[model samples]
Target: MSKKVLVTGADGFIGSHLVEELILQGYDVKAFCYYNSFNSWGWLDSFPKSLLDKIEIFTGDVRDPNGVRTAMKGCDMVFHLAALIAIPYSYHSPDSYVDTNIKGTLNIIQAAKDLEIERVLVTSTSEIYGTAQYVPIDEKHPKQPQSPYSASKIGADCMADSFYRSFDMPITIVRPFNTYGPRQSARAIIPTIISQLLNGYEEIKLGDLTPTRDLLFVKDTVKGFIEISKSNFLIGHECNIATNSEISMQKMADTLIHLINPSAKIIQDTDRLRPEKSEVFRLFGDNKKIIEHTNWKVEHTLEQGLQATIDWFSEAENLKQYKAGIYNV
Candidate 1:
């Protein structure tokens, strides 16, 4: 029999992709999606009928311990990907970030400990490192939470570490740098650019184009997660899945513009700009640890990945879902 796995936040972009990948890898998957009155499963609902039928969907709030515990039952491993991730939204609602990211992570760890789940993977973000103090940041780099979103993730990481040290619970922190591809929310830069250009917009509204990111494709990230879960050496450790390369927002936008609409221009929209202190200036991650520990490698080049993303967003049905004219966050 295959190992049963539970993936939290399976309704969102990366989470949905992970679920599909896990299913393809022959794991019996249970998806924990945020409960809503609309009865929507977010991106998970976009899956094909065949794929959707294989998943066991649990709808509940991650912040609720009871819900988390209930969803974790009968699963051999847990991938905790649920969190409040939008930095701009976090600035306006730091309290919700605390409740969801920190407390919700606490709920997962506590429940995992109690249940003695074989392995638990907590998702971390590149934003936790803030502007890189040094190039190609290793796992040992100092964490500077420049924004509330990063602050909550930092708290969550500490909690995961505490569980391992204090209770000897098995946990791994999987830190992914700037993962992008199909199904990404318009709030993200890549999708923001793609949707606008595909929507026939002449000007792309953006902010702070100088900040750099170490981009990773979603497929590679999901593969890294699966590989990490299969290895016993990564327990109680943090690892990053990155391309070991960086791209500035301005440069990335220009590349997309060149492909989609060469005539389109990037416009600095004041509303889209982040507060001076909250912006993450640069993120170039070192993937050496994960590469050494797991059977993972960069599969897609930036050009290839961006092309795939553009193709997905170019679909009339998909492009219609995003409001290219307005700032998403």
Candidate 2:
């Protein structure tokens, strides 16, 4: 029988894409979506009915241990992607980030230990490394929690590691740096720019264009997750899914404006700027660990990924989902 996998946060941007890809690969998939009043499945609701039919949707909050346990009951593997990821929002309400990111992850691994689940991949972020004391940051780099969101993720990562060291649980912390693609939240830099330009804003609003990032296309990041899961060598270790390159916000904005609207210009938005100390100025990740362990490689270049994202946002149906006129966080 094909392995049944439970993907927590499967209703989210990266999570939805992961679910679609997993189903296409013939895994019996259970999508653990955050429960909601409108019965909305986040981006998963936008998926074609044919693909939607193939998934087992489990509606529950990851913060609840009982709910997480119930969701993992029949699954052979677990991909815990549920977390409050917005940095600005975390600043406003860090308690929620703690309850969800740290505690939610604890629930998953704690249950996994009891259930004897074969594998557990806890999703992590590149922000944990802060400004990158060294270029091309590897898994061994000291985790500098720059924001409450990153701090919560750091706590969560530690919790997973404790479970691994104490009980020998099969766990791997999969960290992806600056993933961008279709269905990304407008809170992110790429989507914020794309949404405004497509919506006919001549002067695009932005903040902190000097910061550089190692952008990985969402599909490439997803491929990293799958390939890493296939490797027994990665258990109890952390791996970064990255392109091993870097780009500045200014250059990235120029490219997007060139692609969508040449007439557009960047307009500084004070509200969008991160606090001086909190902002992560640079993030260039080391991908050697994942490369050494798995067959994954970058299938999308920066241009290819940006074009794909722009193409998706240009569509009337997709573009309408984002409100470019207001700040997302």
Candidate 3:
């Protein structure tokens, strides 16, 4: 029998990809998709039938402790990837972020502790290291919570660390910086650019083009998770799955435009702009820790990843799901 693995948030962008990869690798995959009235599995619905048939999906909310505990039973490893991730959405309803990101994570950690799960990978973000006070941000860099989303993740990371120190629970904090690819929600920069360009928009509306970020392709990020899970060196460690590279939003948008539709021009949209002080000005990660610890390497350059994402969105079936004109918070 394959090692049983439970992946929470398997209905979202990265989570769905991770599930497919896990199934391909022969893990007995159990996907925890959020329960919804429409019975929608979100992006999980897009998986090929061959891969889908191999997965055992359980519908539940990570916010519900009883539900989480029930799903965690009999699983050898847990990948906690469920959370309210959109920064703009967090601005309007921070309480939900607290409930889902903080309390929701708390429930997972507690369940892992109770069940003595061998490995628990709690997902984190570069947003925790807000506005990059210094270049090449590392694991030791000071954390500044600029948004409610970031604040909640910081709190969650702290809680995960405490579990390791206090209870000797095996946990790893997997931080990925600005992950983007196919199936990504319109709230992300890459999808926003692609959607607008695909919709035949001449002028793309955007915000804060000056800010720099270390972009990690979704496949690379998912591979990083698998590597960390396999590595003995990563136990109880906070590892970043990132390219030690950076790109400004303007340059990134320009590259996307040139690749997809050269006629498109960028227009600043005030509504999409993050608060001045809260904006993560620069984020170039130092990926030496994960690199030295495991054989994982970043396979896709931003250009390659962007092209693949654009190709996916170019499809009428895929493009129909997104609203390109509206600014997604």
Give the winner by lDDT: 1 or 2. 2
Per-residue alpha-carbon lDDT of model 2 for 1-329, expressed as tens digits?
Answer: 89999999998989999998899899999999999999999999999999999999999999999999999998899999999999999999999999999999999999999999999999999999999899989998998988999999999999999999999999999999999999998899999999999999998989999999999999998889999999999999999999999999999999999999999989899998899999999999999998888999999999999999999999999999999999998
**Per-residue CA lDDT of candidate 3, range 229-308, in tens?**
99877888999888999999899999999998898888888998888878889999989999999989999988789888
In model 3, which regions exceed 4 Å deviation? none
Off by over 4 Å in 1: none
Model 3 steric clash pairs: none
lDDT of each: 0.93, 0.94, 0.92
Listed per model in order, the count of residue pairs whose N, CA or C atoms clash below 3 Å is: 0, 0, 0
**C-alpha RMSD of candidate 1:** 0.7
The 10 consecutive residues of candidate 2 with the worst lDDT sum are 16-25
Q: How well is each residue in 200-299 modelled by candidate 1, as lDDT tens digits?
A: 8898888889999999889989999999998789998999989999999888989999999999998898988888888889999999999898889999
lDDT of 1: 0.93
Query: Which portions of model 2 miss their true places by more than 4 Å?
Result: none
Q: Which pairs of residues collide in model 2?
A: none
